[model samples]
Target chain A: MAFFEAKNITKFFGGLAAVNGVNFRVEQGQTYGLIGPNGSGKTTIFNLINGYFPLTTGEIYFGGRKISGLKTYRICQEGIGRTFQVVKPLKRMTVLDNVVASAFLRTRSKREAVRLAEETIAFCGLTAHKDKLAKSLPIASRKRLEITRALATKPKLLLLDETAAGLNPSEVDEAIRLIRKINESGITIIIVEHIMKVIMTISDRILAINHGMVIAEGTPAEVASNHEVVAAYLGEDYDAQS
Target chain B: MKQYSGAILLLAVMLVFPLAVQDAYYQHLMILVLLWVAIGSGWNLISGYAGQVLFGAAAFFGVGAYTAALLSHKLGISAWWGLPLGAVITFALALPFGWVCFRLRGPYFALATLALNEIFRHIATIWESLTEGMVGILVMQTFVSKVPYYYIALGIAVASVLTVEIVVRSRWGYYFVSIREDQDAAESLGIDTLRYKSVALCLSSCMIGLAGALYTNYMGFIDPRVVFSLHDVSIAAILVGIIGGVGTVSGPAVGAFIMVAVMEIFRSGGFGFLGKLSSATGSPFVATLTKYISEAHVLSFGLLVIFVILYLPNGVVGDWPILKKKLLFWRRQATV
Candidate 1:
């Protein structure tokens, strides 16, 4: 049985559909990759699934329980944690505190929260920068902080939204390592990323979306070879070049 | 060690203040300082830490004061009951006010609070049958000695400051700051932004309301203009936050003392010291100087605010490092 499922999910902003008639599911402890061009409803699907935006139509189920239209925080309490494409760290807070805030959602004790935050910071390789304010960190570290904070929530299903958008090759590689470690911990992940290397390397299965609908869904190699996926995003000539 | 020492010394001074200062006028100024400390600390919690800049704290303050006054006027309840009752009433006001207003973020929410302040003021002034209108209510003071009021006010100040300190160091403080930094981020992380914001607002309104109740008990008078005045209650609260340090626990305490001192200096023309100096000299120049200083106190206060904004945007406690460095440099130059 699927651990998380979005069935025929649709979202309309005014009259236009931002996301339309999409269905996807993540098995327990699986890494699911969502790939799409700009404004193709990839993020919208994540938003809909995470309960950040109410679906205009269709239902989302987590372990057979319907979760559509639940408040974002309520969904989070049900064990879904998400990161933004644009990182939003508490500027006035230390990096440790950024994670501590999220940790408090699961634990009422400040000591436990701090301990969890510190452990997550170390896991994300941010222990050295723990005392530094979040706003002072460079983008690479800020991205790590975003992921660290999400990890602090101890979610069963984690959503990564463009987590590797603007990173150097080494930084992207580091993020991939962190992501794989996260997946190995028995937490399911759905990653929306523009980086092909990161997507192809870690994704057990890939879903390609375009114009608010799914174009292809399969194993990484299978989806990479799909004609519609090539035409929509991978480019028709990409096969010839290889 | 230095931080702990300064706080202990201040507490010691406050404990023996009424004893040391035999002058009733001086004792009154200290009482005002304590009252402002409670109000300022309340303002600091929601605005400085929570990032909800309230423009109408007077709404809750007035509610608390009126709650106390009405209890005495209508039910003949001991005015002291108003202290706790005011906190409850103000919390009631904040629940819906925060629910409706938290939807509007940043400055718009602030404006909503300001509007609430004005609305409360108008209600208090116009509700003749219930509030006795602008004519106000008069309560008998329980104590004429000023010592009881002084201690009670001091206790309130300490309690408020301690509450703010504890909240800022707790999980709620983190949630409040997170909401202020980015509500969307906070929500994404599973923080109920609205709930935490409501918590911060409730805490603030409750403290201010208690202060309001205390005011009525101490002064033996209640009027819409005095308790709910925009300039006195709301702006004064904001000014206290700015002057002390918006986000820090110690900022409001420092700010309250400074604000009260400055206000008294201007209001009483240097605690009537200027009047004595003018009379002693009896010179036209001295008398003219004294007249200008007393009459221009408000102008001077306005100028001081401008100076504070331009030079010390972070407030005295927040900018103490820079101030210390400057002071050290000046001392070195003087010795040279």
Candidate 2:
């Protein structure tokens, strides 16, 4: 059985199917990539998995437990953690406090929560800025803080939405390396990204969708070469011939 | 230890204030300040830390006040029992209210609390048999001297501040601030936003309710208009939080002191100093000016709130560094 599974998931926004009959599965320790053009429901799938909003009609199984109808925080407590597409830092809190807040999910002790937050902050290389308010961090550090907060929740599965969206090349590379490290630590990651290099290099398997329907799913190389995925997302002007 | 020295010193001064000053009038003013400390701390918890502005603190305050008054009027018990009972009842009231209204965020939630204040007032006014209607309920004052009441107010104030300090330092404190900063983010990270908000609201309600009970026991009378006045109780609570510093632990204490002093100053026309000048000079102009100032307390209070928002938006405690710098600059100029 897959570690995480979405079965025939469908969502309707007043007669429009934002996500329709989409199905995907992730192995226990794999990093999965989701890619599509704008409004292709990439983030919608992430939302559905995180239970941000109720699934109009679907079943989401994490560790074989149905989580589709659960509350967002309950879903997180069930070991699925997620980041927003637009960074949602606790703006008034110090970075350390932001992570400490997340760490409280697992432990009630302030000392333990702070200890976990400090470890996560160090792991994410945000120790230098831990004392600074979250709003003061630069964009790259803010994105890192997002991941750092999610990591501190100690999730079995992490959903990252556009983690490398606005970073420069070097920062993108750093994000990719951080993601690899996260996956190596035995956490399954489902990443949504528009940046081809970061997604192509990190994702062990890739799923391509368009108009809320799965266009292709295979190894990264296979999905990259699929004709329909090429036409719908990668653009036909660039040849699959190469 | 070093950080708490200032708080410790302030507390020591509060402990000695009523003892040092024999005048009943000044002690009354100090009691009002202490009462505001509780109310303002309650407001700060829900609105400042949890980021849910409560515009109707008088709902809880009035309920608490009535609880004490009704206990004496109907049950023939000591009104002092109202303190604990009022806290429990207010907690109960806030639980369901928060569950329903927390669905609405920001200004909408504030409007719902305002509606609650009005509802409570209307109920108290209409229910003549139970509440004595607009006639108001009167409780016998527990003590003839003001010192006992002063100490009780001080105890409530201390408890309120300590409650905030402990909650803000706990893991729950972080959760509250996280919810305030960003609700969705807090939820995404496994913080139960609604439950935590309910916790904050319930706590705030309990604190305000305690203050109300104290008010009834001390003041000996409470009309719906007096306890539930939107301007006097609700807005004053907000003013205390805002003028003190919204999320800071000790902000409410400072704000309560300033607000009570300002209100008294205007209400008394500079603590009767203007009246003295008017009578001494036998000047109609001075007498008229004093009367106008006394009557325009609310107007002047509103103007002060505007000034605070403009210049010290974070309140005195939150903007202390900026305030200290400005004061130091002035001091330096004076020396030069």
TM-score of 2: 0.99
lDDT of 2: 0.95
lDDT of 1 by residue, A1-242 (tens): 57888889999999989888999888998999999888999888888988888889999999879999899998888899999898898998999999999999999999999999999999889999999999999999999999999999999999999898899999999999999999998889999999899999999999999999998999999998888877777566874565
> How many residue pairs clash (N, CA or C atoms closer than 3 angstroms) in each of the candidate models, in the order given?
0, 0
lDDT (0-100) at residue A169 of candidate 1?
Answer: 91
lDDT of all predictions, in order shown? Answer: 0.91, 0.95
Error of 2 at A111 (Å): 0.8
lDDT of 2 at A21: 96
How far off is residue A112 in model 2, in Å?
A: 0.8
Estimate, for each residue in B1-336, the C-alpha lDDT of model 2 and write its tens digit.
999999999999989998899999999999999999999999999999999999999999999999999989999999999999999999999999999999999999999999999999999999998999999987888699999999999999999999999999998899899999999999999989999999999999999999999999999999999999999999999999999999999999999999989989999999899999999999999999999999999898899899989999999999999999999999999999
Lowest-scoring 10 consecutive residues by lDDT in candidate 2 chain B?
B135-144
TM-score of predicted structure 1: 0.96
